[model samples]
Target: MTDKVSEAEFLQGLIPQLRSEGYEVYLHPTAPVVPPFLADLRPDAIAIGKGKKLVIELVTSESTQQKKTRALANLIKEHPDWELRVLVVTSASRGNELQVQSREQIQNFLDEIKLLQDSNHVSAAFILGWATFEAIARRLMTATFEKPQTPGRIVQQLAQEGYVTPSEGDFLRILAAKRNALIHGNLHDLPQKGEVEFFREISERLAAESAAA
Candidate 1:
């Protein structure tokens, strides 16, 4: 991003790149159609592709910590298909705070996921299990961009290239759709025991491969 460009210009600049990557990028208009809960907190743009809805927010380092930003993250947290991509044009804040987990730490997380399933915490297991699957996809994926790609995009690319089997990819997408419902303030709907266990199996396999690599 050129330092001379304004936020709008900066965002407009990304449209071609985003579109080329298969995202149907929609720049801000008078009214962007977001969920009712997030109607007031409309993002700078919304990118839809690969079965995902990305809430793209352009923020400076200082504004990243503001109340609205925090609210945006919290509100978007529950939805599996939605992600908040914070594009910080400035480098003033502490750089990427993503933590690195050791092999043992990764194993612990895998164990916790299975434990959740064994304890009959299906909701917790399903959510964490999906997150773990997404996390593994992020680490194992070879694709790169100026910004981090959302998990849906990552999985889609992998599935396209045969890194993930069609059946596996389809199953995950079904679970993801079910998960979207579970998060929108709906707790009554939950995945079955077999589904949660399947997540555990996939997560463990991916974790092992990642560790080996």
Candidate 2:
């Protein structure tokens, strides 16, 4: 298997991806102001589009959690828009323990964002890790397919029309779980042969669903 990409490069590439996907993104590298002072906090990167804004803070060091907390504090102070989103980019070596810890931290951050939204300062909030890009992409694609008027929904409807086996649906769910594991940086124990077979099966099922539709 290939070595994981560095977090810095991943964030760099991810910024444009977000832009292309119609999200406004910003990078905040330093805290904007001291608690007792009033000043405009400069973020590392900021993109504004799609009627919303996203603030990104990239950390490559072992102290990623600390850095994220600090950046989030500054973002709350500087941005008045209630619909702010945050992205945390770090290496997989940080391990699952750290990942769980980060999720807790992100939950708190989401709470703050929701407060802003409740006050009509923003619309929504999101927290994403750079390592989870592929998984996120899959989810976005699936959402698109599931939309009422999309071809994906049509394919699913056709599958139901043909009374496809419930096991087929179970297999798709399993594939999604495996993809989720890989995206969350928890695939170190994944069996290579099983993954290959699962992918092949999913591909064939998807094709059949499309044909039936």
Candidate 3:
């Protein structure tokens, strides 16, 4: 309802809500991301469903000219399967220099994740584990980058900034998708307990060091 958030944050928030409605979201799709029908065009984000595809465009004050925007809008209007949703953003994120959680608070959440895991609520544990990752990763990301990023981007940025290794980043990216499914109740099987523990450990360490920095 608020356009005060940056386009990145706005897009990030839509992803989960869209997934909950059975949509498959693709961010900044390129040739390989979309089928040949949309190969020549790029949307800020794409949400595909059984018989429809939503083409999302974020318009800032200094965004692409109105002519281009109109063209894209008109092009989509001709297609029955596509619909355009434009987001008019008033401002962009400039990043933050602060962490979102206290060390004690993060530790408490970590413990809760573990408790759920040990109690055979592994699905809940894994879901909570990723939420923990987001809290810490957001802190690191706001401090390091100029814009707010999604969980997928946060993991990549953490690796790029040397906060986590390349392998850790790769694994986290895969988990991020599963996390989406878990959050939306589409996941059938819980991830391995060891995998959840690894994610928890990484987040725990990141929160400590990020706060220290």
Candidate 4:
């Protein structure tokens, strides 16, 4: 791994190896993104697990404080949500890398949500479906925001950051409220089946668009 090809070779060798361990890893994501608080700096890749996010950095040398190496440490320190893991791979023969633990439950829950969406079970579908989607939103918010926020505030932050439109944010706020009420057994305030589906549709669209953007 020498020349300009080293970085690409490193990332290519590492990606599937990481995925094989069951991480929801993203590589230099182009959309559905909020950069780290540090300007002009982004992790080489990110991996999300149960309650932890990993920011991966490839450093050539640690003997000196290169701009990127210093910035990477600062960004990790600033974002309490993420754990920083740096691989010092300067030498061409270096093969060291972090073996991140898996978060299979999250993937399982997402699969369950898809199944619920197609099932005839009404209340189970609505309640679990919304909760699952909310879990996703919460994960994104935790990754983006500096501090914890309420559900509505999460949507607000997304909108303020230009990730979501104001109209979409309004819709999500109402949806989140209904999801919360459902979780708390406020059945009377629960959205109707159609309403629930509508919210899910909109949420799915937003997720898909952002992923594809």
| lDDT, residue 194, model 2 | 40
Residue 133 lDDT, candidate 2, scale 0-100:
22
Question: What's each prediction's clash count?
Answer: 0, 18, 0, 0
Per-residue lDDT over 102-210 for candidate 2, one digit per residue giving the tens place of the 0 to 100 score? 3333334334434433433321121222122222222334443322232234334434645335665455445445545644445354424444444333443433333
* C-alpha lDDT (0 to 100) for residue 31 of candidate 3: 69
Q: Against the hidden true structure, what lDDT does model 1 obtain?
A: 0.63
lDDT of 3 at 179: 72
RMSD of each: 11.9, 15.3, 15.0, 19.5
Candidate 3 per-residue C-alpha lDDT over 117-175 given as tens digits, one digit per residue, 9 for 90 to 100: 55444555676566566667766665554334457877877888899988898889888
lDDT of 1 by residue, 10-92 (tens): 78887887787688887773353677668577677888889877777664422323355456666766676776655544332
lDDT of 4 by residue, 1-213 (tens): 552367667777777766765667877754455354656677777777677676676544222323464455555556667655544343354344312112233344334434434433334445544444444454444455333335777677778877677787787788778767755546577556676566566556545544443
- C-alpha local distance difference test of each model: 0.63, 0.40, 0.66, 0.55
TM-score sort, best first: 3, 1, 4, 2
Q: Is 1 or 2 the stronger prediction by lDDT?
A: 1
Candidate 3, superposed: residue stretches over 4 Å from native: 1-99, 143-149
lDDT minimum window of 10 residues, candidate 3: 90-99
Top candidate by lDDT: 3
Better of 3 and 4 by lDDT: 3
Clashing pairs in 1: none
Query: Once model 4 is optimally superposed onto the true structure by TM-score, how far is the C-alpha of residue 80 displaced, in angstroms?
Result: 47
Candidate 4 weakest ten by summed lDDT: 97-106
